[model samples]
Target: MLITISSLLNQTELAETRDALETVEWSDGAKTAGRTARNVKQNRQADLSGSRGQALHELLLRKISGHPVLQAAARPAKFSRLLISETADHGGYGDHTDNALMGRGAARIRTDLSFTLFLSEPARYEGGELVIDMPGYTQAVKPDAGDLVLYPSGTIHQVAPVTKGTRIACVGWLQSLIRDAACREILFDMENLRASLRASLPQGSRELLTLDKSIANLVRLWAET
Candidate 1:
């Protein structure tokens, strides 16, 4: 399911990250792209193995781990490294899907969902909308700073080139505990309904119990070991 979580980073945290990224060294983004994706990726990325990169990763992980909305939607089993990317000089990535598998050996993660945590304000950039092709429609997502959009890993997506100013974002992927997207979608909907029903109906109502049980069963059916 395609979803946008807002205020992922508080005002203070967002400002701190933006300040740090202003002077952070960046390398060619193509270095990490797959063979075909590399041809169209023209942005710059931070050295993900460096000290600054590690710090960014830790900070993001801590924040993500505590986000209830992200926890419900992503159900992340393992998260990949945070890639701080910037686009300027009319730079951006063309349509491409992320690698199915990331890392190696014991640290391997199967990408089930992809997320782009936008740090640049919408007004700061001219034309760098994140376009994701869904089943029958194309969604152009250009969230405000401190917001993030998450989509299925296999979706065909691309970043429109920046025309006027620089666009900065932290991109990453995660392997979800619930492998099936449809199943997770159902659980998410059920949980949301459960919350609403709890407030509208009595706590011990039969409707709540039935929905809560259904959610448990779906989680059991979809959750991966």
Candidate 2:
């Protein structure tokens, strides 16, 4: 499921972080890329172990991970550091999938979901669409600033080149509590229903109660921990 959630960061957060992102020093993106993936990787990423990079990681996790829509869709167990990537003239990431695992020992995480949070406005860049390859068609997404696109970790995807202006985004990987993609989709749908019904239906209404019960049961059955 390819899901795009808007306003993952509010204006205040975007305003603050955009400046931070602009000032941070970056490293070659190939530093984290695998052998095969490095061949096609041509962008740059923030050195996330630094002070400002750490701040961006914490900020994104607090805002995006806590979002209601993202929580419903991802059911995340752990999040990697928010990786800030930029593409300048003739720069872009070629088709590749994220790593199956990240971190070591106690912090090891299985990547079930991958996400890209746009930090720059679309108008600022020329051709930096997030091109995701689906079964029969390719989906190109160039969302507004503060919007995030989430997809399965194993999907074949690429970032198109930025010809005119630089393109910057915060990307991350997550481990979902529910590992099965189909089960996660069902839970996501049910969770959305639960949220909507809570507002429209009366408190403790039979309809609301029933839906809540279903959601709880599904989560209990599917959740990893």
Candidate 3:
């Protein structure tokens, strides 16, 4: 399952972050792709390990780390620093799965979650929609500024070519505590239902107790630990 969260950051924060992004040095992305996206990949990506883009990378990472929904879905035991990408001239990310290898000689760690935070306004781009292939549902999302899109890292997904201006965004990977999508979906639904019940029920209502118990048991049944 994929989740879209809007307005992950305020206008002032977005502006400051965008300004910071301009200072980071960008490099060609063609080497990362083969033929499909290579022909259309004209933008630059900030080097996460380099010293020049440290500040901007840190800021974006901080924001994502504190997000409630992302935290719930990612269930991240560990996360990588933020990486920025600026795509233009029909810019798009070709279909590619994240590499599971971690450090120089550490045990292989799976990439359980993937996130894309939109840094540009929706009107600025033409066709840079995110396409995710699900079992029966095909999700196409192009969210507004400061919005975020999260999905399973195992899924084969791609970014549609951007025909107009540039598409700027931040991307990151997460190693989740619970990696099963089915279990994650069930937990996410329970959390949403819990919120809804809280809003509709009076304080100390008997129904609230029943709902709480249901949620607790579900968590016990599905929790990875």
Q: Which predicted model would earn the best lDDT? A: 2
Q: Say which prediction, candidate 1 or candidate 3, comes out ahead on lDDT.
A: 1
lDDT of 2: 0.89
Please list the Cα RMSD from the true structure of every candidate, rounded to 1 decimal place. Answer: 1.5, 1.2, 3.2
* lDDT (Cα, tens digit) per residue for candidate 2, span 129-197: 999987788899999999999998888999998898989898889999999999999999988887888
- Give the clashing pairs for model 2: none
Q: Backbone clashes in each candidate structure, one number apiece?
A: 0, 0, 0
Q: Can you tell me which runs of candidate 1 are displaced by over 4 Å?
A: 48-50
lDDT of each: 0.88, 0.89, 0.76
Clashes counted in candidate 2 amount to 0
Stretches of candidate 3 above 4 Å error? 30-42, 48-52, 100-108, 202-225
Q: Where does the lowest 10-residue lDDT sum fall in candidate 2?
A: 47-56
Over the stretch 1-225, how does candidate 1's per-residue lDDT look in tens digits? 899999999888888887666656788999989999999999999765657666777887788666888888888899887788999889989999989999888778999999999988999989999999999999999999999898999999999999989999989899999998988887788778887888899887899888888888888878997
Deviation from native of the Cα of residue 30 in model 1, angstroms:
0.4
TM-score of each: 0.94, 0.96, 0.83
